[model samples]
Target: MSNPVLEIKNLHVWYRTYGGYSRVLDGVNLHVYKGEKVGLVGEAGCGKTTTMRSVLRILPEGQAHIPEGQILYHGNDILKMKPRELQQVRTRGISMIFQEPAAALNPVFTVGTQMFDVIKYSGLSKEESRKDNIKRLAIQAIKEVYIPDPERILNCYPNQLSGGMKQRICIAMAIVTARELLIADEPGTSLDVTIQDQVHRLLRGLVEKKEMSLIMITHSLGVARELTDRIYVMYAGNIVEVARTSDLFANPLHPYTLGLLSSVPKLTGGGVAEGIYGRIPDYLRPPGGCRFHPRCPRAVQRCREEKPLLRDLGDGHQVACFQV
Candidate 1:
């Protein structure tokens, strides 16, 4: 097995609101190895983004807190890092590709101005007419993402470019830094199918060529299959299953995972895809035992009263379901 570049162990997170604290993640455990592509897939509000933000220690300052757990990158705990060290970790270790490029990119600035600012802060262009070197690197990164007209792209504002183009710009910004890990949080949100496919292909190729680890946060099982080596199926703030992508797809162990795979729409004509019934449980007062038991068709008495630990079945496949 590859060395673990990032390890999240028994993670428990909570968000403070006016009403009370909402338990967002309950003893969640995830680890990504060097040069590995891992996928986190679940419905909205399932703590996918929370896990990524926690690693960066960039959670809403006073609104979120990690009551328990550890996030270690390269053997250093990010939660305990001083601000200066944390800043170094972000710039030199991890890069993030956000869901919406419009919000991620500065609306007031042109692409050239924004990318130049990043290159400046990166300390990569310190000598010999910084502006010229920054522009050259920015153009090269843009070209790497398969953008045909790098000069035209740099002159345009976020609003002037299409959704696909803006997303590509986001990828360019992320790749130019040469960080060790890239966390893509719904990187294909607003694009059409063809464009989304292009984005996924671009990300896969870039990660491989850069030899960087990737944490892909997505909803589509198809995208997960295409990009990830391993998959984690999350439901109600907990991981229900973890396995190799092909193994999980061929023989999904958890009921929640099976339900998720069934929910995907098919191109061929058929009856509507069946969705898991009931809404995500209230986080403030989540169900007592297993979070997925309420929606799982195979739930038993033990499933409702006792929580299941993620136990390895074989060949590194692990699941937290009593029935499995």
Candidate 2:
């Protein structure tokens, strides 16, 4: 396999509060090869978004601290990059589609204004930065997302557009600037079911067409199965399992992963879906050893005293639990 477009190694993040620091991400390790779509699946507050935000170095500086980690973008460490280098990365190397479309766009600016600004600053050459050229590129990008009447849509404000339309516009902006990796933090959120499907399909098509690596953070296991090549199952700030999407679904290893898969409602109408027994552990005072030990049915004394590192189980499947 070729080198990964993005790699995160031994990442640990914390948030400072009156009650000391909260451990948000603990020893997270992940990678995305070129053109491969990877899924990060976990319940809310599992540090999925924190991991992505750390990749972009977008975490709030005063509140968030990274005591250990390396975020490598094509072999370069993003955490140590200078401002100019970081700016270049933000403009051309990677882009993120935030969860809320309405919050991402500025209500004060017209869609064209925002789109043109993004295109202009997206590492464009002096000759390509002209107003006319930027407008043309913006229109072309909007067209790619299957939005109709690009010109008219561009002229409208974000408030005037529907939720789906705003999301497509956000997608257009992301693709226009993102040359290597696109981090989508729940792009289909807050939309109708039908529109959500359309957005997911559009994202998959765009990633394939552009040959860009993707990290799709979604709560829906069904969406993860449908869209990603590989899946990483997270639990309370740690990655409990990693495997090919098909393998993870067919034979989940970690106890947490099993719970997640079992909780999903079956379309074929099996009785009530089984829910995970316990809620996520509190970050300020998380369980000592394996974070999921408190909720795991098969947990032993070892699981309660010593944290388990991810162990390879052949064929690139890995789980961080002793019983597995």
Candidate 3:
């Protein structure tokens, strides 16, 4: 086993809200090994996006604060890196494909302009920083993602392209520079089913071809099952369960994980799909013990008093529930 490309240790992130402070991410522990595709699955507001943003130190400066935790990229702590070192990491080590392609792309700038700028600042050597070389690299990247007419597409503004095209452009930009890890935040959420499938396949192929570790944040368990090697089930701000994708689907331990698996719609015409009982708790005043205990069907008295830590069952299958 080689070293992890990225490792997050007990990350705690908070935001200063009008009501008080919201504990957005609480002691999140996650790691992505070299070339390993990991899935971060949770309902909305479960801090999935926040955890990834924290990895790049992109959280709102004044509003969000990391009281404790370490975001280690390779062996160094990202939380303590200087600006120049952090810039190096962002340009050469990691890249992110945002959830909304429209928001990620500058509507005003032509795709060529944006891509050229990215390549120029992508930690390229001085000899490779020429305008002609950058344009060539950009075109080649767009082509690799199966987007035809790269030159014409680059000349167009973001709004001129379709949703799927914009997403491919974003992917092209993310992979233009060689990176060790890529964080994809629901890249296909806004696309049609056909386009979503294409995008998913494109991502799978790209990760394999480039040998890049990936942290895919998604709401669709089906998508996670298809694209990830392992899955992390999150509840509120805690990771309730972690296991290989096959093992998780076959034998989920945590009650919350069970609920999530049960909620997935089946093709065999099972009655109506059942949803998890309760909504995620309020972050400002979250549950004291197990965050999911308020809705856990098998919760015990200890579940209401002690926060269970993730304990390994076997073969790296871990769950953070007292009953389990």
Query: Can you write out model 2's per-residue Cα lDDT over 1-324, one digit (the tens) per residue?
Result: 999999999999999989999998989999999999999999999999999999999999999999999999999999999999999899999999999999999999999999999998898899989899899899999999999999999999999999999999999999985589999999997899999999999999999999998999998899999999999989889998999999998898788888877888788878766687889998999999898998998999999899999999999999999997
For model 2, what is the error of residue 97's alpha carbon versus the real structure, in angstroms, after optimal superposition?
A: 0.4
RMSD of each: 1.4, 0.8, 0.8
Is 1 or 2 the stronger prediction by lDDT? 2
lDDT tens digits by residue: candidate 1, 68-132: 99998988899999989998888889989999877999998999998987777764635833778
Off by over 4 Å in 2: none
Q: What are the Cα lDDT values of the candidates?
A: 0.90, 0.93, 0.93
TM-score of each: 0.96, 0.99, 0.99
Q: Report, for all candidates in order, the number of backbone clashes.
A: 0, 0, 0
Candidate 1 to truth, TM: 0.96
lDDT of each residue in 1-324, candidate 3, tens digit only: 888889999999999999999998889999999999999999999999999999998998999989999999988999999999999999999999999999999999999999999999998999999989999999999999999899899899999999999999999999998999999999999999899999999999999999998999999999999999999988888998999999999998888888887887788877755688889899999998888888988988999999999999999999988797
* Model 1: ten consecutive residues of lowest lDDT: 120-129
Q: Mind sharing the TM-score for model 3? A: 0.99
Candidate order by decreasing lDDT: 3, 2, 1
Q: What is the Cα root-mean-square deviation between model 1 and the actual structure? A: 1.4
